[model samples]
Target: MELEDMPLEKKRDGDGEGTSKLVVEAKAEGKQTEGNARLYLTGCLFFTLISLVLMLAVIVLSVKSQTGSKDCPGTGDDGRCWNIFPKIQAQKLDCHQCGDGWLLFENTCFYLSTVRLNWSMSQKNCTAGKGDLAVISSQSVQTFLTGKAKSFFWIGLKHDANQWRWVDNSALGVRYWEDNLSNGDCGLLRGDGPPLKNWMRASCNSKAYFICEKQHTSLLTILWTTFFMYIKFCRIYGGDKKDDAKENLSSQLSVELEGERGKQTEGNARLYRAGCLFLTLICLVLVLAVIFLSVKLQTGSKDCPGSGEAGAGRTSTSLTATCNFDQCQTDFPDIQHQKLHCNQCGDGWLPFEKSCYFLSTMRSTWLMSMIECTTRGGRLAVISSQSVQTFLSGKRIGLFWIGLERPGSQWRWVDNRALGDSYWDDNLSEGDCGLLRGDGPPQKNWMRAPCAHSAYFICEKQA
Candidate 1:
């Protein structure tokens, strides 16, 4: 009976040992599975993080390309390309300020006079203040001044030499004249009527309050501010969010992985929550990126000012999408029939077909010619119509520079319009500026010349 009991006790001990061994093996296998799951999760996370980083890099590079250092026609002293007119329209980006008692609007500063004076006296006072009398070129400008005007204000328009013209000698663009007003040479803005029809003809000697306008001098500073602000915002709001997400994910994983098998379901639940949070953050980032790109495109393309010939000094690339010949004709009716005897273009300028053409007697390089034309508030001539071509050809006595230039493989006008009518005298493939040969016929007189070569140039502006 004792021997039988001993054998039974040994068998019981063996059974206990076997049970312990099996439990240990099960625990080891569970640990291995958990380790593998963590490894797989980490790999997926790492790949996702890398992909996010790469995507962000692509976005940054694309933005940089748009605002890159392409040569602007008028570079500032700091070697930075600054667009004057376009920057004006971006008032929120402006860092400039007007003087005391001056009102700031767009890219210009205006000052309302406290005293009444005649047109000549008002202009003289404005000039003394380093500005000119208010010149309203658009309906927005008219509305702005109309809001500020309490009484009759002397503007820069005048019926000079039989046609309405601005003080700068530019022909009126959009008229706001009230037909019932008294006839006179000077222009006045009446504050009591419709904003668009408040203008009235007044005597040059009539006394009235005046408005003065001057261009702001802080363009370069504004550009520097905008560039740095954009970079800083991108760093703060664009790229750093990903790093925060990575840190949060790491913290969550460490906290959730601390427990054993009993907490396995809880760990998986935490992991799901973490993954959802990460995915949500990523989705938010993508949405923000899309919004950023949309705004950049709109501001960089559509709303950019200085796209026309008058404002193309900063960006040599013109955004004029259509041929302006018909528009020019529409703006000035019967422009071809308008008498040249009006002398509206002043001395040395010849008026033809709603535009004024000035042939420089002195010779200059193409770039210098463009600069000079810009200074004179005009551009190098763009010959669009056959009549204009005949007129320009007839006026030229030598190789004269025009506004046409080959920015790329195709020749384009300075205003960025594609070359429409061809009058090439030679198949010249090398040179940047277009030259009109005076000796050849109008139909076949165009020539290409080196931009660096000195030649007579013709400047044109709205007459």
Candidate 2:
């Protein structure tokens, strides 16, 4: 109650003091907030700087590695380079130079000599140059050498043990002898002649230009380059540890895939072999079944009704027994005689009387024709009768050889029968062998000709 009665100055002073206290407290809170903002900004700047430095380091390392790889040498005129890694370099690297004036073909270097030399001297010169005489194994190689050879050239072929063989003890497969010559022991390439008639035999002492051959190099440098390129590609794609892990995983996956492919291939091969075996077995079974059915049918056909014992013995009798169609028709009334008569002649012969005749359609020498007839258990036709001569003359359309020959001064048959009556067109005793001349009359169809001449002949056998 006493404070309420006091003047407004006292109230004003109290209010002023409370206002000052609130202003001071707000100023302290503002200072604390500003200091916290500065600390947070400084931490953010530090983190960004650290990240930038790490990225710069990675870029510099990558550039250096690229530059070093690009600096590798040996990539000269051919655009090929040697591998830096010793392990990679050891694997089938091809780094050879075919010397000056030498031509490279496939994996071999060839040198055509300009100076002429004997075969022995030329081979010696080739050996001195770390090569050997050119050995032509294929047509393409022969063609190449022929084109290069401006003159006659000595080859690696030589006659040994009565046969042509290569210098390296290999036998010749294809021959290109000119005119089938059997004169010289050494082989030569006649470059001046046509391509087909380029090879000929010559004396070894004859002087001629020659060819030399040696291995060039293997083609494995490309693989080495590919390996290094793969490594560079991995390094650029990802950082060291991560990319290494990725590459390892990729390698493992590739290995697994390759293994799986191999297994699949093996499985397919096994399946193919099994299928072939199964088909073979099925075919064998079918053949056996057909044979068994055929045997059963044959057995059933032979078993006549009410003739069980006799039918069983028919197999032994059929081999030596001659079937008389008249008797068969009387005994078995159901049997047909005409069908039985059709099977009298064996297989491929024309039946006339009791003998079968095979007409001549192939031409051969007289001696060769006789040999063929003898193989078939027959001989040339012996025209002892006029009817037989007429039959042979009527069927022939050209001059055909017979068994008659004049081995001595007299004409005789191949079976040593002397010539009885002469049916010659003239008394011409110039030739030695007899032939059935179809161009003349049938009565005088016999003529003499050389035995070495080729003509068709007839063969006769019993039916």
Candidate 3:
């Protein structure tokens, strides 16, 4: 009777305890699976967000590469793009082809003759080449010719009928004539003398080397130079590292997803599938990024404006436009600003310091010259210092009406600034307007002249 009772009690205890233990194990397993799915979902979302951020970074870098590093204003319809980028047009090699033994400078080709010839013969030779003898139109041209001149060189200048004239019949606006004005009518450039006063008159029959110039063909080029620069930058800044990091992260995620799939129950299998979908989405994003970059790399716009090309005339309308002309200049100063020419100051102008100067070919009265400068959005040049005076004197061969004027008793600039440093040739209280005598010493070149006197003038404006 005792043995029978013991067996019954043991059976009841095993049934109750074993059932409770099975229920607890099942609940624990379910909780673990839910936690793993939540973790995998969080990881997928995090990686997706990271991929999105990386894609955006690529887009931003590509845009920055398209435009220059410096932001400029006054280029867009809303006044937010850089005027400098458009100005940095790359000339196509095919468009500007200088003959062998000729040097390309700006839009013109220069050739220094090996044989010596008289002024008349030199002019004839240049005409034969469809050009003319060297015309010192600006200080830059003068400098260039001076650098190339080994000895005396006959230029396109002759003192005819008391006035110096170029081969093209244009009166000499800027001159580099030496102090000693000889009786010779032809112009000779002295390579050994000071650059400012290298020109000396000589007989037309005197033998000397010559220079020839001609206009270049039209500008034709695509703006792929900037795009290539961007490609170079990406190559330098670890493009491979970025790809490797992306690949490594994606591979790690794939391995983890596979492990999750192997360990998960049927319910958690959905989570594994979702992770695979997320991975596909990431790959799609990567593919899209590649496509976007490829398209951007291939589609660079033409930079040459007024070339009659459809894309060349339109300005950049990106969202990064925000700077004005003045602001753009102030933000990014050019490294070789002093070397720049018409590109900085425009045609028929010279850049000096922060100013652009225009020496007029047409002569007019002092008042009329002032009016001409005003109409051209400039004013008569103001000689404020010795350097400026020297530069002005070195640039011309004849008298020019400056901004100086006597309004009442005191001499003042056209801008109403009181005369500080005077460079008067004589203290004669005779005329109201001032004339800058280019042939005289820079320190004592200013002379009072009649306001009604006709002469060439220098116009000044901020560059």
Candidate 4:
């Protein structure tokens, strides 16, 4: 609502401009007063608009502060909408939070993953964990999982029992598995295991570790031993306290409980934020990758098979099937990318253009970045080729170092190459644009925007 819409304490400035002092005036004439009211109304409208913009900006920032990360599928507690972070509506029930490739239904985790191990070993492991090969019944679960794994595995069902039986020994429900037309076949999913991401068929003697599903609920409730419960019990039993005393106690208790809750909440919030940020970073990487892949797919006509692990900074050439969290490792190694090259040259450097570029460590004036890069026996990276441009294109959105800047604010190329016209963003000339690391400017479609703005910097020197 506009401020003018509500009656406010009246105040007005004197007509004199330079003589600034506290002064209030009331109109004597009705016509003049009406005019004054109109002016006030107009001012109110203008101020209201400005207020609205600021409020919206704050709200957006607030939302970003809370929800600024990627979405996760579970929160141990029941979810609340006002939470700074949001959880994925679906509960992830994988063994040890191994999210994407496994499914948890009922009290067990089922391997929707296409990982290969002997059917028997997989069964024994699942049996040890109180679950068995997947006995999927619902179409939704099947569709949700099979879409990713795109293959099948030996489930708990086997032919030795002389009947279609699940490893759990429970009566088989309606099975939605599309048959391969084998009459004596046991339960099987159409998938091969790790490294292949393909399909295979075999007996139950497989020795792979089975993924068992469990509910999102923790093992047991310790609420009775918790601080909140203790406070409640104390409130009910403490009778001799005065009403005011009781209230004070309750308030203090409430604060303590809230603080405790806040601690958990904040902890979860931080976790959520971290998860989200990681996810956001992942998604951003994925999106850029997808774009690049799509481009590569178009150019290569789907003939050049790319390795996901190789793309993720692994230095090995072997096709790795899974991630190893103990060490920051991915599947394929030996495949080379510009970023991988930088990874090859450690100490906050990323490889690009057959040269090492420093990571963005802190924002500095262009002069500062140049000096630092120079100290490292390099200049700010000036991306010169399509290969370099494409490599940098896949990086996170930020201002980063490049080997270009205004010397004496002349806005000339460092190489002293004769120029036909200056290439800069926003029509900025030598004076307005100042300096650029990339030909494109900050947030420009092709330009990385600014250099040395993030907490990291990239210094590059020729090989």
Q: RMSD, each candidate, Å? A: 22.8, 33.1, 23.6, 30.0
Give the alpha-carbon lDDT of every model. Answer: 0.64, 0.57, 0.64, 0.40
Q: What's model 3's lDDT at 396?
A: 74
Q: Please, what are the lDDT tens digits per residue for candidate 1 over residues 1-463?
A: 9987998999988976766565566556556655654654565456455545645554664445345312223222111122222331121222125643467888788876544668997787777677888999888888998998888889998897889998888999898988688979999998777898999988999878788888876523443453465346335433211112243443324333332442553354445445445544554555565566556544444222223222333322332335244443333232222221122354677877567788999999986777566444466889989999999898757989898888679888866579999889856656888988877899988888889999999988765
lDDT tens string, model 3, 408-447? 9998887668999988886554799999888998888888
Compare candidates 1 and 4 on lDDT and give the better one.
Answer: 1
296: Cα error in model 3, Å: 20
Q: Cα RMSD (Å) between model 3 and the true structure? A: 23.6
Report residue 338 deviation for candidate 2 (angstroms): 12
Candidate 3's TM-score reads 0.31
User: Where does model 2 exceed 4 Å of error?
Assistant: 1-348, 375-377, 420-422, 426-429, 439-442
Residue 268 in candidate 2 has what lDDT? 39
Residues 1-463, model 4: lDDT tens digits: 6688444423322223212211111112323444544454354345434434543444444333223221222111112211212221211211232222234454434543222346665554445444455655555554444554544455556655556666556766655444344443455555333322222334455433233343333211221123244345335532222112244453335444444433443343343334333334433443454455345334322111132322344233332233232222222222233222112244656765356666564677654555455444455556565566556545655555455544343544333332223334554432211233333433432222343343234566543
